[model samples]
Target: MDNFLIITCVHHFQKDGKFYGYGPFIREMNLWIKNRKKVTVLAPLIYSGIPGKIDLEYEHPHLNFKSVPAYHIQSWIARFKALFQVPYILLMIFWEMSKASHIHIRTPGNMGLLAMFVQILFPFKFKTIKYAGNWDPKSEQPHTYKIQRRLANSPFFTRNAKVLVYGNWADNSSNVVPFFTASYSETEIEPVRKSSLKEKIKLVFVGSIYSGKNPEVGIYLSKILKDKGIDFEFIYCGDGVMRPQMEELSIQLDLSENVKFLGNVTSAEIKSILKESHFLIFISKTEGWPKAVAEAMFWGCIPFTSPVSCVPEMVGNGERGVLLSTNPEEIYLALLPYIDDEELFQKTSKQAMDWSRKFTLEKFQKEIVNLECE
Candidate 1:
């Protein structure tokens, strides 16, 4: 391919001539651009903001970033605005995708939904889509999300597109490819050893603190453990709208000594914390692939998560971690076994670590190279 163009939903901002957005998205896109001569990105450029702790940018020198209007489907007013804004964005997407040798779309977002529809006009173009949300065919989601999935899954409609999704489903379209995102380099892999039968267990929550991620559930679980006289420390490593609520509830539940909100931390700090912690909690309502769960597993931390989407597959159907019910009593029982048996704990940890380490950034890059060859 002569030119590689990526149209994504992730909002990127420019600062000091550098583009910044989500770190993991940028990392994966970096791999996608490795062998291309020219690269262009058509995304929202939020110009008035500084980079966050996890925000990063594309480092490609010959990069062209085309700015487009961002749209939201939240309120009536936003929807009214989107009626005018969405078409503009779609036209921009069509303009950019038309000039590319390859088209890559990142979902599930408003931009991705637009891209899915826009891409249909160019049926013969080479395209790849990373559907980075819940890929469960049975999961409940918004209408936009369902429409995006339907458009991408229809083999005839979304032709010449490799939809890289999180899990292996029973009857997916031929275009649907199972894919994984990476965090650490192969050289960064070290021997990690953790056991739950310690004097004090360290539990980590590594996602956003909001309703979608259900970060409050982690605090509630910790409170339940505390009330039962269990000795554990809850560490929240992300920030969101629910941080204030989590803080207030922790205080009300008398979990001051047990729960600690670390806010958004650096990748290195997160890695260090995971390496030391015995368990990682990710009881979310939905997910595509919980990258944090896999990252924690790579450091010998067992995943204590809901069986949503591909989580059961990622955690080996509760073989390498704890698959929990929404009920507090059931979750408590599921975790109780881990705190007593050292051998079982070590086995599970090792199983998780060995499985997760197989999908490093090096491997991810090679896979991209192979995809290019195809």
Candidate 2:
């Protein structure tokens, strides 16, 4: 309980002559290390030749960082490199884990999967694995992902450990705990007003503009609206490999005027956009409890998303917003009615805001504190 050791697959980088990592991941960890005496982070710290748009440095001072060589199962070459490197990584984890009584592993990732196996060597150490991805017990996924879930969910395998997951799945292990992540603190909460349907519809799509999250779905939504001569704007708030491709597709669809891509912005900037936006079009192919969806709902921005993972429960089974289909035509038809009905729009926005506010960072941090202390 004195020292908190964090392990994850999130790559750390150096920019502006300072160490940096993903903003939201660092922010959540910042909340976690509040009461701890010493905090340590062990993960792959890559040296990117060029600068990144979303890299954020850790906020705490005088903290320890152990940079392990980053590896993945993406390509055959990478897999071969990892085969020789994994043993060294495991040795490093074993040594680092021995130094702390409290170990936190960020799961559904390659590094986390490795940590899950090594933690068995230290059953006496209390560990918490935060499964940041989809946790549907029956959901189809890769072998590695399934193995990590199996190891963590078995009391016999992973002793003295607890898993923090998005949803409450039936027939779970004793250590599996239902939990949530938050972006804003209780003090950051403000009076949220419903967006007016009379104005030009503004849709915000947050998350990496990758094929998996399907930024194309948002663009297609804009295309459908534009074809009907409807006045609306779709703004993408994150950057990824598919960003350029999505941008080109937007122009090709003749949606140049309606679609806007704001590469990557800070948490503050996104919240400002969410406050004024009418809907968050996050029709991703996969997600856990996406912080973007919850943040949008927190500011009275209705969500228009696919029922991936626990999104249906998060969006109140389409009561708070629109649940979409794979077909762009069907998605358009489902949303067009809400666009025209001002009263219905106002009602759902309120319900969404109320639900999201209940899961603030203050509450989230308290849960982490309890788990860490115990």
Candidate 3:
């Protein structure tokens, strides 16, 4: 049987016995595995209550899942133990990697590090690394993350590998290829019923309310719109460590009437909410490919996001979306012009939707086939 070893640090196969996270990544793999009679997943698993996995159903005849302890370290002792656990984990993955004709890895994680080291032992192996994170060299990151990127891109370190990254970054090795996640399709496209430009606009922010995502920016922008006498409401979906702080900021800005936090939601529910929103406010400082932003664009919601990682590329270099400035005041002033422009809004929404439609599951699977082929 043709075998493939898929490795990652993220909790892919959860204890709930369902795969989640990196939805597009896993979905593409599931499709590609059809070519191989046998496929094995080597990754962490966590217990959860999430109903359905992203791609695979519960019973896939050709799939084999081997989960390791979630790469978790709290104290110095735990951290030391984790360090020792790396070799054993690598041994487990190497066994599968040796048997497989193709090897796929998700990098910048504990498991990724182990795989990276093991990959060095088999320089002739055919492998691919899907790096689902901000690839900007200048962006601040953990030491291990920086090391992983360097090693994975280094000519001497990484050979016979294709390193897939979210956005196009400078000075990348020949192996680095830019990629994107898809949402809807040409057939799925429908006429969006937009609200009147004269009426209150509905806005949305769907992601963690953390420093990286900068949920505060959404609140600040909403307050600016309110002060400008613009009738608008911003809804935030997704809970995070910074939820309490963000809620406090909303109240402090007297934006309680204009902003609502709906917390985390399911994909179906999120899609329904997007249909009702006019724009998606994502001021994230960094991203590989923000799925929420792409999803928003798919539903005809214009995105207002900071030009981080591949965001500019994803949004068609601001043709279909708004780019944020480092200065908060500048961002507020820049967007004020679009507050009442109906034609601009419609054109931008259509452009966003059209751009997102180009990257579909069918297209993604085709690319993977090419990558796996000689």
Please give the lDDT score at residue 247 for candidate 3.
93
Per-residue CA lDDT of model 2 for 1-374, tens digit only, reads 47789999898886665667888888888888777788889998887543356666776665688889788768999999998889999998999999986899999898998999999998888898888888897787888988999999998989999898888888688999988989888898888665466678888899997877877888877888888888888889998999989989998999888888998987778989999898888878777789889999999998888887888889888787778876778878877777888888888888999999999888988898788566
lDDT winner, 1 or 2: 1
Candidate whose lDDT is highest: 1
lDDT of each: 0.87, 0.85, 0.78
Models sorted by TM-score, best on top: 1, 2, 3
Winner of 1 and 3 under lDDT: 1
Model 3's alpha-carbon lDDT is: 0.78
Q: Please list the Cα RMSD from the true structure of every candidate, rounded to 1 decimal place.
A: 1.4, 1.7, 2.8
Model 2, residue 236: C-alpha shift (Å) = 1.0
Task: Tell me the spans in candidate 2 whose CA falls farther than 4 Å from its real position.
Answer: 15-18, 49-53
The C-alpha stretches of model 3 lying farther than 4 A from their native spots are: 12-25, 47-59, 72-77, 326-328
The lowest-lDDT stretch of 10 consecutive residues in candidate 1 is 190-199
Say which candidate scores most in TM-score: 1
Clashes of each: 0, 0, 2
Give lDDT tens digits, candidate 3, residues 1-374: 57777898755545444455445556556666766777788886655534332323323466778878676576888888878776678789788888887788888887887788788877788888888788899888888888889988886888898888887677899878777666554566676787775788888998877888888888878887888888889899888899999999899999999999987776667888898898888888768888888889888888888888888888888898988854657777766667757887888888888788777777776777787564
TM-score of each predicted structure versus truth? 0.96, 0.95, 0.89
